[model samples]
Target: MLDSLLPPLNEHNLPYPDTIHPIVVHFVIAMVLFAFVCDTVSYFTRNPKLAEVSWWNLVFATVSIFIAVIFGQIEAGLAEPYDAAVSTLNLHSILGWSLSGVLAAVTGWRYVLRLQNKPQLPTPYIVASVALVGLVIAQTYLGDLLVWVYGLHSVPVVEATRGGQL
Candidate 1:
């Protein structure tokens, strides 16, 4: 019936052979980076125009990050990590959840700044934005470890899992 159009399962038994989390999360990362860059550059250049751009980017990023986290949680649950990969997966999951909250809080603060009489971000908000970038970088490293070091969805690992040899 409806399953006629569905793709066959891969070695990992996923209906579609690819990981969905990475594709969505990369967009979240890019949007957050672009937002921070626009904000920082605008702060220094005194270009009010860039503030509008930055605000929109942050808004989109905040919304997109939740989507990324949801997909990440789903994919991670399906990952079936081997022994050595377990810790990295756990840490990445925790940080992914934390980053979603942090991003939402920062976006809320940015909204407050937009509503201010001056319509300018404060120094503390800027500082927090920079810190957010740092946290994102750390999260990126953990993700890399899972994909590169652990090879979570790599074909060989997938095959092993499917064969019940993992």
Candidate 2:
């Protein structure tokens, strides 16, 4: 029955080098973390200069997310489709896209607020940043589960047998 939901695993048809996939994932995760850290710091410091820097960080993050999304789609295509793992990947994708929107909104709001000479961190700014951080945590967990629980890719045992370690 599980087979009905999940495409059978194919070890020979990987979309990219295993090394490449993990590296891209790590890089993308780092980008998101950087954005989250910038957001939090800007919120606490209430420094308009830091907010400006955070806005640039968010722009870089958005660009990185676009690249990450492409890589993720490729990875997903390489994995079994319709399985629980893919389902979780789907959830992660939704949350990731939502986060991009939220980040964009926050950046725009900050820009406008700066233009208006009201550079103080507003209550909504704090609330949105908090929500974005929560979403980042959830998305990170989903990414971990996709690799750790689903066995969609090579496990450590297989890697060791293949004379490699991930």
Candidate 3:
């Protein structure tokens, strides 16, 4: 049974070399950033039209983030972190979960603002969005460290894991 689970692979390997988390996550990151930008610009210009763009982006990102986090958790679990990578992996995991909650809460708040038919986002909410961006930047850095620095699911790591040597 275990043998069947662990099939042989070549350098050409599993659909992609790494986990699918990053592929999905980049969408969330882009959406969140763009949403914030739209909101900020609309706020300064007092053009409510951009709010529609921001709201839709936020909605899509809210849904996409969960998908990204699910894949992230699964991939993180499967990662065979070396001693040096363990701390980084743990930080990345913690930040990913934290960001999920923050993103959901902000989405809910935005929904409320939408319901209220406000002309623009409240200053506080915009500030919160700025903070969210900061956290996201930090999260991106950590994720990069894991994949680029630690090489979590790189072809070599995958090969080692498949061979029970990771």
Q: Model 1 off-target regions past 4 Å? A: 1-8, 117-119
Per-residue alpha-carbon lDDT of model 1 for 4-40, expressed as tens digits?
8867667654666588888888988998899899889
Query: Against the true structure, what is each candidate's TM-score?
Result: 0.90, 0.69, 0.88
Local lDDT at 27 for model 1: 84
Which residues of candidate 2, in runs, are more than 4 Å off? 1-12, 19-28, 155-166
Task: Give the per-residue Cα lDDT of candidate 3 at 79.
Answer: 74
- In order, the Cα lDDT scores of the candidates are 0.86, 0.63, 0.86
Q: How many backbone clashes does candidate 3 have?
A: 0
Candidate 2's clash total is: 0
Q: Native-vs-model 2 lDDT?
A: 0.63
Error of 1 at 39 (Å): 0.7
Model 3 lDDT per residue over 1-166, tens place:
8767775543424434556899999999999999999999999988888887998998999899999998888778777677888999899889988998999899899989989987778999999999999989999999999988888878777677668775
The residue-by-residue lDDT of candidate 2 on 27-139, one tens digit each, is: 65576567556656767776667666666666676666666666667766665443345578788778767766766676677567667766466777667767766776787
In model 1, where is the ten-residue run with the lowest total lDDT? 8-17
Model 1 / residue 126 / CA error / Å: 0.9
Which residue pairs in candidate 2 collide?
A: none
| TM-score of decoy 2 | 0.69
Instruction: Look at candidate 3 and give me any clashing residue pairs.
Output: none
